[model samples]
Structures are given as C-alpha cells and as structure tokens.
Target: MKWKVVVMLGAALTLFGCSKPDAEPTESELSNHQSQQVVIVHGLGRSAWSMQTMSDLISKQGYQVCVVDYPTLRQSIDNTLGESASAISNCLSQFEEADFVHTNQSKTHFVGHSLGGLVIRSYLANHPDFVSSKEMGEVVFLGTPNHGSDVADYFVNNGLLSLLGETATSLTTDPNSFPNSLPQPNYEFGVIAGTQSYPVFSGMFDNSNDGLVSVESTKLEGMKDFVEVDIKHDKLRRDPYVTRLILSFISTGTFDAS
Candidate 1:
C-alpha cells in the first residue's frame, strides 16, 4: 500500500508538475563556462520537466545545461537508450556550432538523477565513439541505484512491476538487472546518496536510504568521490546543498566543500 502511494504520488507529480527551466546563462556567466556544458537527465517515469530545477541551478553556475527527455514510463532501458543518446548528441552539437568544441576545446559533463544516471552510463558504454574520457568532464549521480534496487525487486515478485514497464524489471536487485550489468565508469565521476527517507518506508531498507533507493545501492566501484546528503529520493535533484556539491564536484574532482 505504501509503495502504491509513492508510485501514485510520483505519477501525479510527473503529470501535473509546473516545472519550467530557467533562462540561459547570462553573458557574464557564459564568459566563464563558454567551453563547458552539462546535460541533466531525470529519473524513471519523469520527464525533462522534473529536472528544471537542476538545469536552472547549474546554468547559474555558468554551464550550458540540457535536460534530456526520454520515454521512461514503460520502456526497457535498452529501448530508451538511443533516444537518450540522440538528445545528448543534439545538445553537444551546439558547442560544435559555436566553435567552443574545436577552438576552445569544450568539455561536456553529466548530471543524472536515479534512472538518469544509468541512462548516462549505458549511453557512454554503448556509444564509445561519441566522446572519449579526456573530452568527458566529471559525472555526478544523485541517488542512482548503481547496484540495483530492492524496491524494484519487491514490485517484480508481486507481478506489479509490469504496470511500470520493462525498466522496472530491469532495475531489480538481481545481479543481472540492467543497473547491475553496466560496467563501472572509466571516467571521472562521483556518487551522492541520500540519507533521509520516508518513515513509512525506512524499515524496508537495511541501510540509510532516500525512500526509493538505499545508500548502498547508489555506490559503484572506482568512483572518484562519494558523499551523502540529507534529502529524500524525490528531492535530491532540487536540494540546494546537494546542488552545491554537484557544482563542487564538477569544478573540482572532489565533493569536498569549497
């Protein structure tokens, strides 16, 4: 019943949310980040609108930001990857058009929330020709289930996951699930997990969680840095302090407060 409530709330928010992206970076802001870009991706069952806050905050930091829109409702991760990659390519093309990529040698960074992180991982793995590690700037994952999620496992066992789509099944805690199958990133990347959880669902996880994903599930081997924020799963993308950490990690390799 609780999981159903969570799902319904997430659905309603995704459908009726009034999120709007902030304006493009100002001339002064662009002067500093002219050769840098950040692409943000939202979580499962959410759209680009869900990431407007992140886009706005990072754009203020001077990086051109793109919030990717993917068909996340009922599609397999593999099925949706091409669309995700295409959106990334289209965003990056702007840098090329402006000569920042060739003349200034721009770097592209990624910021993903929950399922969005996995989308970036899969995109880089499957499309190696797109960008090399040297050209890839830092990546930041906010509450992504890098090791898969038990909440997904629960839904799968009860046969209710089909209602959410194949990606739900792929996100289960099984060793072979999509998130588990992805290789560890070979680029500069950081992980930020949330310690806060909804009281009703906190008991479901053995460790700290963000209501939807356990802190343990958000980790991966060889991450450059890792930190925890006091926020829930749905709020990680908008929390100001977490945004500061994201900016810190992007500007510097460590999330150590500046």
Candidate 2:
C-alpha cells in the first residue's frame, strides 16, 4: 500500500510540468581557465535542476561544468543520448575556440544520475570513436540502474510504466529492455549506490535499495570502484558527501578519498 502511494505520487509529480527544457547552468563561465571539463546529466523525469548542487560544487573546484537538460518525460532515450552528446561536444568546442592551451589534451569526465548514466553509456557505445578521440576520463554513476530496476518492473507489470514515457519502460528489469541491452562501459568508471529504503515499503525489493534502484542494480562488471551510501534515491546527487565521492572518483578513479 505504501509503495503504491509513492509510485502514484511520483507519477503525479512527473506530469505537473510541460515537456520543455528548464533553464539551467548549462556551462559555467570559463573564468578559471580550467582545462578539465565535467558534464552532468540528470535522471528520469527530472530536469538539469536535479543536478544543480553537484554542478555548483564541481564548478567551485575549478572544473568547467556542463549540465545537460533533457525532457525525460517527453522523449525517447535515444534522442536524449544524442542531444547529450551534442551538448558535450558544443561545450568542449568552446575551449578550442578560446584557444585554451593544450585544449586537445584536456580530459573530459562524465557524471550521470539514473537514466542519465545510461545516456552516457549509450553515447559511448554508439560512438566508439569518442573513447579514443576525446581522451575521455573517468565516469561516475549515481544510483544508476545498470541492471535495470524492480520499481520499473513493477510499473511495467501493472501496465503503468508508460505514464513516465518510454524511458521509464526502458528501465524495466527485462533482459531485452533498452537499458539492460546496452553494453557495459569499456572506460574507467565508478558506481555510487544509496541503501536507505523507505521502511514502510522496504518489502517492495528483495534486497537493499534507495527507494527506486536496488544496490545490485547499480553495479557493472568493469567499474573501477563502487561505493554505498545511506541515502535515498532522489538525494544521492544532492548530498555533500556524495558530491565529494564524485569528485574523488573523477580525480583519482576511486571513491576511497571521499
């Protein structure tokens, strides 16, 4: 009963806004002349606003930040992935135009929450050239369901997943779902999972979860590192410690420092 209420409320919130891109800090002014760039993408049914906290934090650390805003409730995942790639490309191109010294040698890192992580994966999978051409750095996945999600499975089984658009359905645990079908990232990456479940609705999952994605669902075989936190799904990107973890992994390819 509690889980059903939560799902219904989530669906209601998702439908409250029009299918438009929200104004976001797409790229921080390149005042610091930082060569490294960090691109962040928000999760399902969320705007780039969802990643604002992390963006600000990373910006403070002197890295240029680009927040990709996609209409999660209105478009297909493939479209979102394409737009995200374009956004990153455009953001990086500016550095070259500015004639930043050694711009070609600068590292590009990615941070994604939930569906956003899959967008990064899909982009890399489809554009194999980016792996070598871009000189990509490490990636960080915050509560990303690399193995799909039970909540999505429940919605699919009840014929209600479509309410959140095709992206939600793609998160289902089905082996053939879009997310599940994507190949594991061949680059350096780390996974951060939240373990605090809603006690009243904990039974919804057989193991620990962050109200939406199970801890196990966030793991990938090639991840350079993995870390768990006592947080809920929505707050994973906002937590200060999680931000530190993200920064640590981005800098060292490990979350141990944070």
Candidate 3:
C-alpha cells in the first residue's frame, strides 16, 4: 500500500511540476548543440502519469521529454507493443518537426520502467530502421525484469493474470521477450536495480527484490552499466540516486560508479 501511495504522490508531483508557471523551455530554447529528446514509458497497471517525476527531472537536464502512456492490463503483449511503437513513432515525428522548426536535429533517447521497458526494447528491436542504436542515444531501464518476474508467474498460476492476456505471458515467462529479443547489444544502455523489499509482498519474491523484481534478475548481459540501489520498485523511478545515475549516463555515456 505504501508503494501505491508513493506512485500516487509521484503522479501528483509530476502534474504540479508540469503546470508550474515559467515552465522551462524545450531543448531547442537553451542549446545550440543538437537537441536530444528523451521518451519515457511507464510500467504495467500504471500510466504516463506515473512517470511525471522522471519526465520533469530529465526535462530540467535540457532534453525534450515526452512521457508515453498505454493501457497495460487491457491489451495483449503484441498489441501493446504495436501501440507503444506507434506512440514512440509519434514522439519521433514530433521531434523531427521540432528539428525542422527549431533545433534542426534528429535523435532521441528512451527510458522505460518495468513493462514499459519491455515495450521500448521490443520496439527498438523490431523496428531498427526507425530507432537504431545510433539514433537512440541511450536506453535506460529501471527495475525491468529482463529475465522475467516470479510474481507474474504467481499471478498466472493463480489465474489472476487473465485480464492481462498474452501480455502477462510475453512479459513474465517468455524467453523471446523484450530484453531477450534484442538483436545485438549495439546501443549505449544502462540498467538500474532496486534492493529494498516491501514487507507485504516479501513472500512473493526471492531475496534482493524491490517487492516485485529481484536485483539479480534485473541484470542483463549486454548493458553498458549496471547499478543497484536501496529503493523499492515504485519509489525507485523517482529516487534521486537513480535519477542522477540516469542523467549522468545520458550526458556522459557512462554510469558514475563513484
């Protein structure tokens, strides 16, 4: 329940930040260097509203930020992927327009949380022409179950994952899933893992989890860098440490181990 509260608070803060007067200008307004846009995607059972904190913080760092939302539990994984791809494509088109109208550049970075991470990776893999590693500056995932989640297994075994349909299986147990489906590790990418465990759902996970995904499972072989922090799943996205790490990676193309 505390995790849910954290998510709600994050949503509220994001809304407040966006609505603030004197909202900062987009990347073009402040930079002569080519503008880099960051597209944020949220997790399952969540909305773009959930990623408000991330969007605000990254935007402050001077990247054009667009937070994407999709119906997580209402669509199949394939359908979700298609929808997510469309959203990303739309964002890219907007970036192209901004380039022609303002910065005159063409590129974007993508960051995703949980299931959103899966969707972004799936899109990049299947549509390499649109979002290749070169065009995609960096890919960052926060607490993604690149290996899959046992909690999802529990839900499916209990017949509770029916509402999620193929999305549940595609995300949870399928070997050909997002991170797994990526062709080659050609993009600059990083992975951040959480170590705090929520007591209410402790029984559902192995040790070293942020209530849902185990820290070890968040590790993927192809990532440029990997980091672990003491934050729960829901709070991890907004945690200053994680946010700072992501910013550092985006700017420097390396994770600050210090």
Candidate 4:
C-alpha cells in the first residue's frame, strides 16, 4: 500500500500562530524552542521512524519531540510498559526544565499508537499523578484497544501463531485481561479510532474494526474526546489527518468534535 502524509513545514505554525517556517527540519534535527515537550511512541514491532513524519510536523509547533522505539515482539507486555515509562521520563529529562513545578512541565504530552497507547495508560496507572501533579499533559491514543482486542485471542488460540509474540495473551478481550484492566487516564485524553476493517480478521470482531482493533474496542470509560477516521491501524502514525488531530489535541486539549 502506498501511504503518503501530506503536511508542510508551516502547517503547524499557521495553526498554532507561532511563526512562519523556514523549512522542514531534517528527521535528525532537534528543535527545543518551545517549553512544551511531546513524546511519540510507536506501536508493537514498529520503529520510531514510523512516527517520524508526524513527529516532524509537531515540532513545527515549536515543541521538543522524542520518538520512542522499543522491542515489542521480544518483550512481555509488562516489560514493554516499563520501557514506555522509561521512554517518557528519559524524553522529559532531555528538557532541563521538565519538572513538576516548571511552567513547561505541565505541557509534557504523550502520543502513542496501538499497544503504545496501552503502554502509556499502564504507565499512568503506576504513576497516577502524571496529570494530577501537573507533571504531564494530555495523552492522545491512536487506534488503541482500550477495551481489549479479539485478534489477540485469535493468535493465542492458534498455537501456530502464538510464536509471533509473548504479549499476545495480554491483549485478550476480557476486561480482566491487561488492556481493559488498566486504569483510565487521570489526565485529559483523546481517542481516535479507525473505521476501516482489516478484512482478514474483521469477521472475528462483532463491530467495525481497523483489521487488528475494533473501533468499539478503542473506546474507554473516560477519554475526554473521541473520533473516527477512515484509516487502518498501522497507518495511523503516517496519516496526515490523524496527525493533525493529534496536534489539535496537544495544542488545545480537545479535538475537533465536528
């Protein structure tokens, strides 16, 4: 599939009223002009490069950004969440002023795709003050299974496919399972669900799904905002529309409800 995210350097600036963009920052360029920090985490088995375009576009808004990558297939779900916590603190540590009392400290936002979203949620569960103490900002979940996933069950049921990952069972649809058992975000959060179904496993899900995750499963009890886009699960990181919504929530604490 040919996927292209059409975003310009000045797009974020124009929307945030920061300034005109000189040019697109190279993927390796690090900009720390703004006090706000946005950490981006890729989904299971995905690299930080998958989120590079969205991260670059967000940097145009004048915020420091860190794209996190971890070994999802190799680690247990619990271990991956530990990596998520480590990534968030490590990313925040890069900014000298990212502390609870600092002005910019309150704007530390986390954006994650798929299981990465669950990772953030799990992190917040352990350190619930991520928002209460104002140590962090809102979280944006892209195609996360806040409820749980059936695909995981399918894999766990098939011994042949179980070798794919050690964390698949943690994604079972039972609320008692890891995903649903996670505490809801104590801070402001927005969820974006994909409406397109992955035809292969869509039949397993009783509702509209994005192939791997169902739109219904993407919801939670306390997300501040929710929306659906006609995209796939893995594609959320690269979809221009999805990234724009992420920026909107990051800048304004709410997505375009309309």
Estimate, for each residue in 4-74, the C-alpha lDDT of model 2 and write its tens digit: 75666475334211012212222443433267788898888788887888898888776778888877675
Measured over all alpha carbons after superposition, the RMSD of each candidate to the real structure, in angstroms, is 4.3, 6.4, 6.3, 9.2
lDDT of 4 by residue, 64-113 (tens): 78888776765677677777788777786776454423453346788988
What is the lDDT, from 0 to 100, of the residue 76 in candidate 2?
A: 76
Best by lDDT: 1
The reply for model 3, stretches above 4 Å from the true place, is 1-34, 99-106, 131-134, 174-184
The C-alpha TM-scores of every prediction are 0.86, 0.85, 0.80, 0.81
* Ranked candidates, highest lDDT first: 1, 2, 4, 3
- Which ranges in model 4 have alpha carbons more than 4 Å from their true place? 1-33, 97-106
Per-residue lDDT of 44-158 in model 1, one digit per residue for the tens? 8888988887788887767778788988767866677878888878877766576444434467889999989998998888767655745578899999989887667766777
Error of 1 at 92 (Å): 1.8
Q: Which runs of model 2 end up more than 4 angstroms from their true locations? A: 1-33, 103-105
Between candidates 1 and 4, name the one with more favorable lDDT: 1
Which regions in candidate 1 have their CA more than 4 angstroms from the true location? 1-30, 99-105, 130-133
Model 2 lowest lDDT segment of ten: 15-24
lDDT of each: 0.78, 0.76, 0.70, 0.70
Query: Per-residue error at 135 for model 4, in Å?
Result: 3.7
